[model samples]
Target: WNIENIIDNATLKYSVNFVEDVVNLDVSPGASGIGCTEMVISNLGTITIDVDVEVSGDNITISPGAVSVTLAPEGNITTPICALALTRSEARAHPVSVLALGRETNTHLNQVQVTSNFTAIVDPYARLSIQAPMPAKHCIGSTFWTNFTGVNNGNANDSVVFEVSNIQELEDAGFTFTLPILQYQLEPALLDPLKQNSFQNLVIKVDSENVTEGYYNMIVTIATTMDGESFSAATTYQIWMANCQEQDANIEDDSLPSISLIPTLIAIGIIAMRRRY
Candidate 1:
């Protein structure tokens, strides 16, 4: 065992070190309709590295797959990352991941990785729709009530605004609208149907105590706006003027059927004609 003493030397290695921002990356509209952000990645290790990046999410893309970094202890690169929604109805923030993988330039070893998590911004979309049934006829001189169903089909919480499109025309034709002129707030449409308040009644008074036998048509509209996007819906109301008779509520006629009914003679004739059409 006299000549067996020998010395051996080994090198200690450090893995590649990388750094990235863990923040809410703001998204801006890209050339067509896609949303994107500029990502800054840095190398914080002693060795130079060649890195490749990746993303995990729907419609997400990274501009350059790989970049070379020289280390003065820190080297940075800027790249464009983009994301988008599959449909206009889909609006909300979504979470995604950014992955950086790298290896030392000289030995092609000391492999390492870094992960950055973020949320992509997609503004909420809002839409409104109104549905009202055709109303029944009543005596021309009494007041009446009509109603409509408002639906917020958009993916966010929003209110619907009401407008009487042909307000002046109908008013000139011996009709009046009390509901559209008033404020009716709507519950956010994103709630469950069973817990939603989406129905409303419109009131009108006919000064028909001396009007004619014809009818006037009324127009109603519902609308909403969000983040520069707009949506609107419309419905029609017809006012039938006949010294008909008396029955229930005593409301006039414009966007609703009155509570009262006309005489049996007028009802019978109109019922027969209505059956044919």
Candidate 2:
């Protein structure tokens, strides 16, 4: 036999194609707490494939990391990916890597990397309280002053607005008052969590010309809006107003009898002392 024929007969050649090398994955950014992003994996191979997924990152995680997928020649599946940001302070871009492996060969066929930017948001909560004791009495045409303290109990920064309601209702019941500031801003900037701000010297004036002497109930509301959501706290105060002219007359009437009896009592004591001597 010829040497060239023997060599040609002994040699054999074949080709193998791996679909993982050319596969493409789609990923997007995720929102913290609110929701997650969806990532799609497509299989473009000649044979059915079972893909196993794994995620590597501190700020991101994959649901059902390992999946049993039977691709009919060419198929696709979508998976949910979530971001692990829990606080408002965790506002940053996070790097996440996803790897898909072939179960039979245990080979890493494809890797997809993404920079997920998550929104840092928390529930908004606040508490409102009167910083000073409510004035028991207010004179007509005089101003009543007090302080209100607001505390932010949530993790986010917020701004507070003040509202005074039931004023007209109180006026209907013979108690009239005026609030100089209908809507007062607590602070120019956002208030942080567990932080407090005071609204100093809030003036409530009794209407001298329009109000009748009586007691009235008023409601004060403190509200804050964040991310299209609203949080509010409310409190009530009782206001008592005395007519200035009537009050002066009553004082004068009560003092007149006492003033008239003092001289008579003094004379009797002098006479008693003279008799004893």
Candidate 2, 1-277: lDDT as tens digits: 1111110111111111212211112121232343355555555544445555565444544344444444444466665554443433222344445555432223323322222122212233333333334647777666555444444443334456666667668667655466666444443213333323434335565554456787766676667665554667777777777788888999988966677799999999999999999
CA shift at 92, candidate 1, in angstroms? 2.4
Using alpha carbons, what is the TM-score of model 2?
Answer: 0.50
lDDT of 2 at 222: 69
Model 1 bad stretches (over 4 Å): 1-33, 42-46, 57-78, 108-112, 180-210, 225-227, 245-277
For model 1, what is the C-alpha lDDT against the true structure?
Answer: 0.55
Q: Which candidate is the best by lDDT?
A: 1
- Cα displacement (Å) at residue 66, model 2: 7.2
Clash totals for all models, in order? Answer: 14, 0
Rate residue 196 of model 1 by lDDT.
54
10 residues in a row with least lDDT, candidate 2: 1-10
Least accurate stretch of 10 residues (summed lDDT) in model 1?
1-10
Error of 2 at 51 (Å): 5.3
